[model samples]
Target: MGIFLPNLLVIGGVLILPWVLMLFNYAWWRPKRLERALKKQGIHGPPYKLLSGNIIDEFRALKASHAKPMGLSHHILPRVAPFHLQTVKNYGKTSVTWFGTDPRVNIMDPELIREVLSNKFGHFTKPPPTSLLKQLVTGLVTHEGKKWAKHRRIINPAFHVEKLKRMLPAFSTSCNELVSKWEQWVGSEESRELDVWPDLQALTADVISRAGFGSSYKEGKRIFQLLTEQSELIMQAVQTAFIPGYEFLPTKGNLRRREIVREVKAILKSMIEKREKAMKTGEADNDDLLGLLMESNFKESQEQGNSNSMNIEDVIEECRLFYFAGQETTSSLLTWTMIVLSMHPSWQVQAREEVLQVFGENKPDIDGLSHLKIVTMILYEVLRLYPPAIFLTRCTYKRMQLGGINLPVGVQLALPVLLIHHDPELWGEDADEFKPERFSGGVSKATKNQVSFFPFGWGPRICIGQNFAMIESKLALAMILQRFSFELSPSYVHAPYTVVTLRPEYGAQLILHKL
Candidate 1:
């Protein structure tokens, strides 16, 4: 028994001890060391707490900020991200904070942000995705290095301008359905009050489903519905993620999230299999996103060999991305655009006038959309004010020099896009005000070619589907403006928040006057 006990102790020292030491380093020692290093470099923020660090503080701030809705104002950073606002206010723009044991340094400077995002030597990379986040989507958004480049190359063809031109029919069809429903709701009555948030959500989903899967749109819609539920669960998980293995707990929400992921994958697998078989048989029209992706994948396999081609699992993840990112970005943009236009009726009128002058009663074509100067200006302003994504985060894996700061490995650099977009110094004293004219001279003139305004991100990793999103938004907005003159309904509450993307927390209620 004494010999067995000694052997067990030796085994523990050899195996479990290293893991324990590593955990201690990650959860305690490393953070303290990083904190000291940052402080020495003149970067300071909230003091780090053992294990939980600033996560609990962040949660408290978030809960307090979101307890009630704000007034009708464009200055939404405080409500949308209270903790970040407070940290930046306390420690200057490029300051540090903790997300669990990791140090998060907020970089509100546009030029530094450009360097981080551009990632010239690949020092900064996308932060590893959490398990809950993976439930929402993966593929390109989560991948890095060679995998990201490969996937991006394969997916590029699907979003080319010529390809988007082909998908215009899908965009138009989706908008037509929305117009029809709203028309029916306003039926014979001069005006009707309705909450447009869910309707817009549905519209973007429908467009993605149609454009992504073509004949398998019904299946795609089912997958998106599950994805929506999964996203909600993920947000809930985000609040308590400091608890290790929180996602694996046998809780109702976690179980439901698992179920949702399984269902979505199953549906996507069936749809993909059918599409692949049809394509091989030459019975499929390779026009939609999924078909185009497969065609691209096939060509890539032929050119670069099968090893470089995305496998079935990779294809599935990309499809999930197609639905999640494609729908979330455009829906959030359209919803905010509607709410903003409602707030400023003058701009709405001007946008509608521009739309009318460009297309009259005709459906908006791709060329006409480009000429929508006023409408384009409004969309840009909306994106600046209530960007669908509030911030972008990159982590340093190896020691890197960013600006004047020496960022240590394992430190996260947060580009607070919301703050950058609303900086008075950058956008004048009326930065918070709704003014589309700031964009009238075009984005390059507006920021003098700085990466100050990156709603779709910037550089090599900029969203591939940006053109698709803008085209869809322009088409949807033009159609809505042509069919209806809308204003904020009395029931509308100005509660902007984030759940994967920035959104109107209580839905956008507007009175639609049928024109």
Candidate 2:
């Protein structure tokens, strides 16, 4: 009896005690402490429940909201982010919502949002994705502090304006191919009712292939296709991510995600091997993104005596970043630009006129692209209205006070870019309206030099590929304007939704008039 009792006690201590502690910390103590802290600061959210916290309610709300598309209006906040809109209405901008037990403070104030993103002290860091989701892609976007700085420094040379100018031919080539394909379908004086959405995605993907990997898109087309599938898988995983141990289960989704990531890694590995061999033979000049990155990494390690050069795995991740981020940003920007321009022909005419006057009957060069004032203004306005990334998130690693609210460690801040962009107080009465004139004087002038316009993000860790994406977008728009004038088709449905990035729920169908 004595031996059995001792054995039972040891077993209980080994298993049950930790479970009890986990329950105590994760379920009860954390929620109440966070709630009390926020409440004392006069910031209250919906009541937090144990275990699930606010996740169940949030999921239900999202499911119901996404049941059907909303009306066609510029006030897209309600459609894209119904939960956020409703929460703000109920609990005010500074309320704390629960993503599991972790309190995600809804930071609507632009100043506070800027403070977190700027992260001067590096106390705030990006919340890491789920372990399974990390398999999707982990690049500089997901890095922090020293790692982020190292990666940024190495990758910076690849996207410099001079290097990008070298890539203009690749951009023009892809655009020319897209235009030619459209021309075949569109004889003189005939309009083609086409969905520019998929076509633009293909165009950007092809550009990334040729410019990013120094090969025709056909060689790298598989990468784009796989990445797209992975993105869809990620969106599914994210909905259930808040549930503990959910990803561990070998469900179809989890299996597929694993398989997809494995395949993607294998593909990237093969490409990197070939490129590395070519570089060793002194056959490449680091022109394309992958080559530039490997060269930059090597030069840094050799010249600066820094061993912080990215490994083969890091290079692969960056390539993933280039393919996914590069393609998504430009494609969304181009697709929406077409839709908005179609809606407002005057702006379209003005932009096309600027493109033509700058470079008449000739290809768009870097010089002419730089001088496209009207086109730049139009793109800036579209970014303001429908930023590709709808929100930027950061979490506190140490207890910190922000905008006068004391936040506990592990608390997240949701800086909803779309909400802040559409705020009337910041952008004047016509904030929701499409007014490229608001940016007539540029982004700094638009926000009165405040951090109000951050479609690509702001501060030290702003998106490194912003210039690359912009130049690619400008080239596509310029080429398209030169070739065709398009208007929204009657069959087009206006349904903007977020699938990682804000996209039209229904495809962007437009009638192209060959110009």
Candidate 3:
């Protein structure tokens, strides 16, 4: 018996040794293999380093470029670290870079991007494992396959034209409050140069709270604050995600992110629970997004004959997503639109004129917003110049052919929307310039018969809230124009950087003048 026991122990040790080595190889050696494969395909960039890869180099470049002031020329692109515009320029349109062990294929071709986003299920899908940040607010944005289809189908009605019309009152109420607040501030003898970014962010948050959640802004404000903090931490994590187990460490940023996530989830849970209780008691009379979602989800549950339809947790995640996705995109749209209008006062005047011509001094209705052609054109132009999401990423789970290249499983692709939007080949030499006239006739005419512009992305998975965002933006812009005229303040800096969305690093400071 003793001899048999010794033999068993020896065999177990031998088996475990290989498994440990294999784990080590997967964590440390696989990335090198990917880098070699990319190199063999004639793809090149900064050479990959151990673990950190090119992350340090990327950050260094971003820091140096950000230190300099932005130039007026459209050619002077925004500064970003680790992955600068220079790298894109140097590597050609379809270059490959190593994000840790993963080989990221950067595709800037508009036609190819259209193919990928359109046929998402066929060629590729959302990354196999979304990061923790994604897990916190996973809904339509992160869902893929059948789940995504179902969610998309169910949520589509919430943003329908009729539903948006219902939500317009909420939008107007929020915008009116913003206008009234600004008017009060402007009435003082001393002129105030305000950072409209934060104000716009707050207004959008309030609007989403009342319109989407049917809740007060007080709770929504807290969620926004948590989301902003989470955004910063997620950016940092993304920069280092290539490193194995980086998120597990108790670093200051990671710890804070975890705490914020907890806080956000807790708050959302309480709100959802309260709303559910109200619904059960037949006291909830709201027709807002929260109410709509609950009603829709209840119907789905009945059809499936499942008691556990969309539970508190599911509602919480969706609500968190509502605030994060809904608020952020509209806020970005408004901020960049304001900046563009400041740059081209003539276009700004044209948009205001169109707004007045259509709606006069009356609050903008759904029909009136739809008819604001000039304002729509200007907004489209701003989106083209500064899209909210600079790039879209996907990972291949099986061997596939893309752009005639044989791609293996685990290869990541980055569809850089910003580069594609500004590509001379697609939009011509004047592509980089802000010309609202391009979109004067609508997106089809604006592209000059090409499918080049994709600010809200392309194909089946285009942003669900595109119409909602456009309506919200048109309403807010119309209200602002009705009440005030503004220009970029001297202290304003043109530093656009990507945290979650491309945003002015300092703030969008504008000198507001009462009309």
Worst 10 residues of 1 by lDDT: 113-122
Tens digit per residue, CA lDDT, model 3, 142-199: 7778777777766777878888888888899999999999989888643568899999
Per-residue lDDT for 1-515 in model 2, tens only?
98999999999899888888887988789888888988998888888887677777876777777776665568887778777778888989788788777888888776776778786437788998658548767889898878888899899999898988888888889999999999888877579899999999999999999999885356579989988888888887866776778988999988988887888788888888888888899877567888888889989888867567888888888888889899998999999999999999999999988989999889888888999989999999999999999988888888988877788888888888998899888998899899999888888789987778898888988888899999999999999999889998989988888887889878999999988
State residue 434's C-alpha deviation in candidate 1, in Å: 0.6
- Per-candidate Cα lDDT values, in order, are 0.91, 0.86, 0.80
Full ranking by lDDT: 1, 2, 3
lDDT of 1: 0.91
Which candidate number has the best TM-score?
Answer: 1
- For residues 468-511, could you state the per-residue lDDT of candidate 1 as single tens digits? 99999999999999999999999999999888899888899999
- The TM-scores of all predictions, comma-separated, are 0.97, 0.96, 0.93
Candidate with best lDDT: 1
Pull out the clashing pairs in model 3: 58-82, 59-82, 62-81
- For model 3, what is the error of residue 58's alpha carbon versus the real structure, in angstroms, after optimal superposition? 1.8
Off by over 4 Å in 1: 1-16
